[model samples]
Target: MSLNYPAEGRNYIMDAAIHGGQQIGTWYVALYEGDYTPQEDDTAANIGARATEITAYTELTRPELVESAATGGASDNTGNLAQFTLSAPKTVRGFAVVSSAGKGTNTGKLLAYQRLATPRAYAAGDVVKVPVSLILSNPA
Candidate 1:
């Protein structure tokens, strides 16, 4: 099974109507080891897995990152699911989309996270691939 939209993120986005400084910047997909867990007090700084994050697969640099489709952004089901191929062995349990390319509390602000229903354990010589789609839309 794949990841579902998180309640933490749902609350955050819902509260944005009353909040003033809540803004999502560039989105980058970050893969974590099977041991990583999503935390409520997560900041951008320490978002990477403990020495287990795939470096090249950590910060996916893309032009049309992701934004709120409900607010005149891109349409749904259109290039929203990001596809990634593992070049090396990776025991991935979950992934996230962040705001920056750098790390640390002030830099690596995580926007969303999802844990795979089944872990993806890829070997060095294996062709591993997964699609992580960001669903940014209205509840209506």
Candidate 2:
């Protein structure tokens, strides 16, 4: 099962096994700052929307599997156990599973944005481990 998501000013396809789409291999992931409404201009280089991104994400460059395909999702979302140790105050509303690592000046494809079940508000020295998952099915 494949779904088309907006990425790099075009539609990027994903095999959403949950939505009857075929499953694929590894994909990159990133944590976007809360209130970051995804836009066409978003790239691997910028976590836009005046939203402050948390760079403490340990697996910023890891290619992980789609943890479990949801039965009615629009795309295949690979879930990962992300742990964050914040050195300053922060609030994270959601995350993004991208097609490539936005390291250096190269921006990759933006797969989808998964909002936290509950927004997390953290203070200095706070440690939070999030089970961030992806939903590529049921396009909005």
Candidate 3:
């Protein structure tokens, strides 16, 4: 299924597929982010947002089918390394693996992967390393 999300200055679309299976559950969700055309200053400008959706209860396939359509990256280290500062230490349950870029002068091009946090303690300026690059369903 497809859905549209409203944003202040951007457009967003989300797609999801629920696999119809047995006891357990599986779903694949993809989000699209983009900006409307034209800018108030008569210049070419755009904005984008990420999209996420909940899977329906009637899905009957593997979420991979849907994820395949969405943006995805392979599992590899040294792909995209990012640094973020946490205002306060919090338990990172999950994260949306968006696009990733590295900052090292000699860093190689790497895919970005978002995953749960490790050790559970994150101080300010703690860096997060995502290994795979998520599908560019959304363009910012």
Candidate 4:
């Protein structure tokens, strides 16, 4: 998974992928801490012993660096499954971010995670809710 937080921005962009390590889960499950994956890079491990050492140093344990908030006004993805960086880092198997309406017609409405979901409203102090449990992946 990768998160793209543009500099000088107030909205954070996030992306995540599932490998072969994730377990089956139900809906509406929230992932907590202590489920992070701490594995070294695969390529580094294949390049002999010395390369493995270097790769270990460059390994990324958590996906926090990818989360960022855009500035000059926030970005909104209303009625859609928007990708927002997780401020509290944890490498789970699977997760999703849900948002409640900030104002206007969508105020206080429950938005499900679907393609129809879009970031329609962007604002400061907006709440980002991660309502799924994250599966921790093992090292390759």
Candidate 5:
């Protein structure tokens, strides 16, 4: 899934790039099962407030995002797909990238989110793999 970096995310890039803000050492991907729509104003806390994060997974924790170098103005975790083995039945609607490594924690920046083209219902033991990307480009 491709990312749509929210306002906070945009600012984070600018800050880390030019304003001396601390660069995030690592970012994590979290899955959500709530009925929620991503907005430009959404933050990590905002997402946590509106969405029900899916934490019943067999994985030890949320997957860490390892991005490739940007080419053609895009970078992605294609080589390192986030894999989740569901421990319980759930319908997953979307995912978000956050600064925190702790599952269900809201304290951090919300980098981006993408609601799936279609929500997927998964049974326990089903594996879900996600590859995420970020693209930066000038407006045409």
Candidate 6:
């Protein structure tokens, strides 16, 4: 899936890249369930309010993102998949990477988000697997 980096994400990248702002060492992945569409101004709080977070899983507290090296200006967690074992059935619409590790908490910078091309419904014991990625390129 394609990822959309919000304003907060862009600024965070710039600050860590050029400025002296502290770089984020780890980011947590969260699954969202709703009809919410990600916007440029979307934040952690905004998303938490707009969508329902799927927290009925067992695995990493919040799936830690492990990305591959950037090649051709793109990096992804292809081999390092985030697997969530659902304790209850839910329809997952999308996912977001944030700075917070608490489930359903609205206290962190929303790094990136992307709605799934097709929503997926899971059974009570289903496992949801996702491979998150990001692409950086100059404007044409």
Task: Work out how many backbone clashes candidate 4 has.
Answer: 27
Taking every candidate in turn, the Cα RMSD to the unseen true structure, in Å, is 5.0, 6.1, 16.7, 19.1, 1.4, 1.3
lDDT digits (tens) for residues 1-140 of candidate 5: 45778899999999998999999989899998998878889888888768789999987778898889889998889898888899999999999889988878888899888888789999999998877887888988
> Per-candidate TM vs. native?
0.60, 0.55, 0.27, 0.16, 0.93, 0.93
User: Candidate 4 residues 34-63, lDDT tens each?
Assistant: 222222221111212211111111113211
Model with the higher TM-score, candidate 1 or 2: 1
lDDT of 3 by residue, 41-86 (tens): 2110111122211111122321121122232522222333322434
- Model 6: lowest-lDDT 10 consecutive positions: 51-60
What's the residue-level lDDT of 62 in candidate 5?
A: 84
Q: Which consecutive 10 residues in model 1 have the weakest lDDT in total?
A: 56-65
TM-score, cand. 4: 0.16
Q: Over 4 Å off in model 6, which ranges?
A: none
Residue 52 error, candidate 2, Å: 3.3
lDDT per residue (tens digit) for residues 1-140 in model 2: 12223464234443353355544355654555666555655654564333445665434443343455556642343344545566667787766565555432235555655556567787877765545444443335
lDDT: worst 10-residue window of model 5: 1-10
Which residue pairs collide, candidate 2? Answer: 1-21, 1-22, 66-78, 73-137, 73-138, 74-136, 74-137, 74-138, 75-136, 75-137
